[model samples]
Target: MNISLKFKQVLNASLLKPLLASFFKPYCLLCVAYEGGELGLCKACLSDLPWHSAPQCPQCGLLSNGLICGSCLNLPPHFDATYSLFSYDFPLDSLMQHYKYRNMLPLASAFASLFHSYKLNGHAGIANIDLIIPMPMHRDRLKVRGFNQALELARLISKSTNINLDYSTCQRVKFTPPQASLPLKERIKNIRGAFSCQQNLHGKNIAIIDDVMTSGASLNELAKTLKEAGAAHVECWVIARTLAKSNY
Candidate 1:
């Protein structure tokens, strides 16, 4: 690329883009009555969203008053910790459904922004991560979806944090029914032996990105695979976590 062209691209991204965006205010995705910010949500709507601020178990991201919950204590998941930004409810649930099923692509950027900013506050361990892996989808499912929502979110996060993102290193080998469709007892079995890691992640601390965590069976299985490949640590970083008895 020409030097001048490179400079122009940077200039547009750093200045011109924001300037143009400022002039054309976008309507809030939720209320639609107010002008939206970069998150596609107005201040009131954004503030009203269910943030996961309650004291909880750091392992499974479920509500727990103390350190590790009883479930994690009894049968620990392969992942060391979990960090979820929102409680999967109401408007958030609707927004996620739109993003994943309806292909609301811009929501990827909005979600990535949420994750990045949340981490920036005090997640010092994020800097220790060697790789960012988006929850891998089976090739068949990827084909039908046209794009992987997790991969899209991870791409923006990788760019912002300058972390190496590896989508290909781990893959969902078993093409099974959607975990959402299955019963709780069937979820772990459905996800069992689903992932395969191509590279040896020896001593690598990894963060896996996903849009929603329901049963957590999928993330647990993936973390197990990464640990088997010698990953030093694995953590789940999801946009939302279902709080009900439905899944995890």
Candidate 2:
């Protein structure tokens, strides 16, 4: 690239960016009400969010648990705790689908804002996070998706909380099928041995960040892997949690 072209690129980003953003109004992805700011949910929608701020059980965010879902009770997840901002449903699910599959990168900022609020409200087990780890995307999957949605959200959360993020320390070694597409029984097998965490996390509190939690097979596997690597505790912080077996 020519020096002049580089200069023009910088100039456009610095000057034209604000001008362009100002030209268009922001609106909620749900109601299309003008208020989402850089994110996609207006104030009304924001307040009305099915806030799953903290789960009674530090394990699964699934509602069937009714204070500590049966899954967690019967077979506790390796992760010590889990928390989410909203229950996965309607417009939120659609918005997340679009954000994840349809390449809506800007929506990450809105999701990150909710995580910031979670911290402010003092969600359980998030008290002292030694490290922030976004659920990793396999290298092949990364090329197809263009970016890791979890990592994008985690980047902002890491910035807000000033916690260290170690994406390189953990990796998705296998390109497993999407858990949502698989039967509940197959979900665990799909991701087994799929992650490799390089660091020795003994006594470290690791927050596994992700866009949503459905069956939680992925987070569970990640937590199990982290445990193998000596992580003292692994907690998951997700944008939404699916209550039903069906992908909401």
Candidate 3:
């Protein structure tokens, strides 16, 4: 099946499955209100969450009023573009914390559904995407965390988009400390040479899905590795983008 047709099927399924599930189990994740339609949030709560609608740089996802930000112009990232669904803020941050640290696994479905909805609205070059890759976690971190949140998300997204998902070709070789815990200035250095791609990806347009993008150091390094392995273009498809300048 083609990308467009697969997207339509996923869209239809996303809409219908949520409505049906809501009827059977109705409680919002945020307010405990009845009939939490999608993502387990009532319509009111969902609307109030910080959705990323503002204009931003296509490369790094930082605010730039819809144009390529000067940051990207000055120091271009390895990734060609970024498509983020939410601003990392307030309850959204709390939600991500719960999902990542507290093991709220069901939120993966919520996140993937939101991502699907965003893609359905249309992107100029999405159809050209040749593969989906969830950011890799080193074996040590995987043993500690018990799961790679990025992989959980990519699994659902790949199923919906019919895009080839490649999880094994790339591996995180360095077991560096979490980027979020490090100082911004040190993050890039800490993540450098952390990724290794075993397979050649010549001329492929690849998308990397992650739960959040803070300094983007990890993504940048991963993109660099992919480019070295001959990927033609790399796109970061993150669920949330930290809007704070400090995070960048």
Per-residue CA lDDT of model 2 for 1-248, tens digit only, reads 99999978886896687556545866566774656555567778877777775434556766543476666767788888777788888768888999999988878987898778764367644567899999999999899989999999999999988889889999999988888899877988888999998878898999999999998889999999999999898888899888764221
10 residues in a row with least lDDT, candidate 2: 57-66
Better candidate by lDDT, 2 or 3: 3
RMSD (CA, Å), candidate 3 to true, equals 10.9
* Model 3 weakest lDDT span, ten residues long: 14-23
Superposed by TM-score, candidate 1 places the C-alpha of residue 208 at a distance from the truth, in angstroms, of 0.3
Model 1 alpha-carbon miss at residue 67, Å? 0.9
The residue-level lDDT of candidate 3 at 117 comes to 89
Candidate 3, which segments miss by more than 4 Å at Cα? 1-24, 246-248
For residues 38-97, what per-residue lDDT tens digits would candidate 1 score against the true structure? 878788988898999898888888988848988888888999999999999988999999
Q: Report, for every candidate in turn, its global Cα lDDT versus the true structure.
A: 0.88, 0.81, 0.89
User: In each prediction, how many residue pairs overlap at the backbone (N, C-alpha, C within less than 3 A)?
Assistant: 0, 2, 0
TM-score of each: 0.88, 0.83, 0.88
Q: Write the per-residue lDDT of candidate 3 for residues 1-248, one digit (tens) a residue.
A: 99999977876796687666666897787786775676777889888889998888888889887888888887888899999999999899999999999887888998899888875357878789999999999999899889999999999999998899999999999889889888987998899899999998999999999999998989999999999999999999999999876234
Error of 1 at 65 (Å): 1.5
| Better candidate number, 1 or 3, judged by lDDT | 3
If ranked by lDDT, best first, what sequence of candidates would result? 3, 1, 2
